[model samples]
Target chain A: MTLQSSPRAFDPSGTEEFAHWLDGVRAWAGTAAPDMSGWRSGAALDLLALPVARGEGGAGAGFLATCRAFETAGEGAVLSGNNVLGGFLFAMSAHLWACQEPLLAFGTDEQRAAYLPDMMAGKVCGAFGATEDGAGSDVMSMRTRAVRTDTEGWCLNGVKTFVTNAPTADLFLVLARTSEHDSYGSLSAFLVPRSSPGLSVGSATEIVGPAGARTAVVRLADVTVGEQACLGGEGAGFAVLMHAMRHERAFILAPAVGLMAGMLRRTVEHARRRSQFGRPIATYDAVRERLVDAALHLAAAQDVLRATAGSADLDELDQARAALTKLHVSREFNALSNRLADVYGGYAMMPDTGIPQLIHDALASRFYSGTDDMQTKIIAEGLGL
Target chain B: MTVDDGVLTVIREAVHKAAPAFDGDDETQLITQQVLDSLAVLKVASRLENQLGVPIRDAELLPRNFASISAMRAFLATKGC
Candidate 1:
């Protein structure tokens, strides 16, 4: 029987193409390639340097290509029990969807040409610095300040916490208050380079999950950038950030289906191999019910994603749908992984099986993009009641 | 027999559960005042949805809809909940 796998959800050609592309990434990384310990310094850049991330593969080859490649990588790594691949994809997705896409949309033509090439080639790593110590959920409350200097350039000062890739990022999309007072239009985004004198990537941050990315405190003490560094300019930060959040919600599920597929396949294989009550445990009604229930959830999550992915603009309704997809899929995948562990009994609990790790990672993902509660709010907003 | 009283009580309880600092004044800005973050807004939505037997659609999720007890009553009244 063809084992139910994550790759099966996509066309065979998509799957095959991604497999080849990812293998090429691995080949490029060579000794620096990802391993059990997690991401290496240069490895992630090489992975991001793929044609899809650069959006150079043409029509179905750029955005779609990146999605297919990551999904395929997630499936293979998950099925073969690679812990770090999912994390790698998580960080990469955040960078591509949240950082690069916004730059393309809001950045001046000059800005795109200057940064996109190096970023796409993985030569200059980048991170979005928005979540401050006090401004996570309430982004408008951010304390970071940017004062336009005499030369029309700006000096930024603030501390952004829990920034993924901050430790290694060469470019930072820093959001700060440009106006003296707090209001909707007070914020602005700036493209600051790591070599800037006053900017510093503070201590490394330790977080939950195997997302193969680095996190740290990004502190800007009078960090200065030229006038051309403004992305959407002053007062545009909030809108830019909102756009990022909406897209983050939509595409963050890029690797989720692959994860669920891995869980289903592993669980089915476990159910078939391990015998209980003188037969394969799959014969048990409770087991069958759990499997059936999981399949339904996975299928439902898939349907939501399929319906929502085509959205061109993440308007209110699209945002709501994206929120639903992220909320439902992540929750279902988390619960399903935990159930699979129960099915494996003692074996699943063992580290070698990777079931327990999957459970932990799922728990980590619960709040990664936005929590279930947050998603509920978004969905309720979409419904208009 | 679920009336405005019931809806208000559920909203109050949910608001307090999410942020005890919250008060149910009709014009209080729950969002701007930080009485409820996105997660708390969701908690309130769930409680309202379950108690009123009325599904809160996404379009009505603006601050004006859940800003206060009076706002919530107006919402439920419009829905005939």
Candidate 2:
């Protein structure tokens, strides 16, 4: 499994276990698993539990396997009608890597025992609340405030936007400013439950890709929670957030690799079957090159994705690596999608063909974890530029 | 000139042990594929540094330094890696 310094067109896949699981997931996504409704099959848990339990070193390898599986499942489903594979898989990754992983890394034993088991068992769905209307890129500029009401209680006020899994999340890891200090360090995170008073989830806002992957605003009008609800301690939220973001940014789109592979395969089939000018489009060197590029991108993305996923540390170096993967893989996926659409021609524009839907969905990949622009910032910092 | 097979083997082994998914040749784009991703990069870098007793840090973190095995070999040769 030695990584290549350079590559040519070739088939790429995961370990036997990952490939086997991916096959099952693809079948599930095209059939039962893509259900928009809560299907307590514990599929998400079953898919992810192994890697996450393995910790960072083991988690890296394990997560790469899981992501490879998710890529195929997401592609199979996204190619067909039930792309809830988009929302479900993305939300699952966010919950596991962003919210749960951080908690597992920094949380108390009581905290882990109280929240994690239920989540692992598929008894609960989780959401991460960080982005705000005024604070997308500049997260530290958020207006959300948390005031210490007592040693064991705190009141939080403000709104969180674009919260994934919010429509069904039983719990939220909310970030809020806890001091007059405007520095990012003043920010803190709270583990707020659905039952907490003054905590309200706005109506689910439909987004570009799939219906199941809903986003909404969470407003806390002086919401109060016990000290036990705090993830890590006060002023530790930024560190916690960075840790979570490092994981999320790197692996958020690992499944898109599968999506690209499926698209390329389908496009090739279409090019051969749907001929023009008395010949198949596949005969054209230009069209062939496009397919080859798609294959090349898929291989390249998997390599980087595996590298980021398999890293041992979660420091600045890991952060840069994850940012690079998120940035490169997303842009590459978008390119592959556009190429796929062009290769399909006018029929690609037709809604029934699902190419248009895929195009729209592919565009949304740019914003999932963070935008490519944000990733560039991290990469630039790493270069000391 | 091509990089010596021994250097290539060590780099490949370091990366392979760290991540089992990558199987690119010397001409493969390592950065694009992320075969030398952050975590694996440290492992490979440390392995090289230990093998040669030279620190690879600071200005040496450039992507071009690790874009491919050939690039890495050339870069390492500059530092007598």
* Highest lDDT model number: 2
DockQ of each: 0.04, 0.02
How much is A205 displaced in model 2, in angstroms? 1.5
**How many pairs of residues in model 2 come into backbone collision?**
9
**Docking quality tier of candidate 1?**
incorrect
- Candidate 2 lDDT over residue span A272-343, tens digit each: 997889999899998998888888877887788767765633233355677898888888877888888788
Q: How well is each residue in B1-81 modelled by candidate 1, as lDDT tens digits?
A: 235556677777767766777654756767556566544665676667766777665434545566666677787789985
- Provide C-alpha RMSD values for all models, in order: 9.6, 13.1
Ten-residue stretch with the least lDDT total in model 1 chain A: A1-10
Off by over 4 Å in 2: A1-18, A33-39, A42-45, A54-61, A78-81, A312-317, B1-81
> What is the model-wide C-alpha lDDT for candidate 1?
0.67
lDDT of 1 at A366: 74
What TM-scores result for chain A when each predicted structure is judged separately against the true chain A?
0.84, 0.89
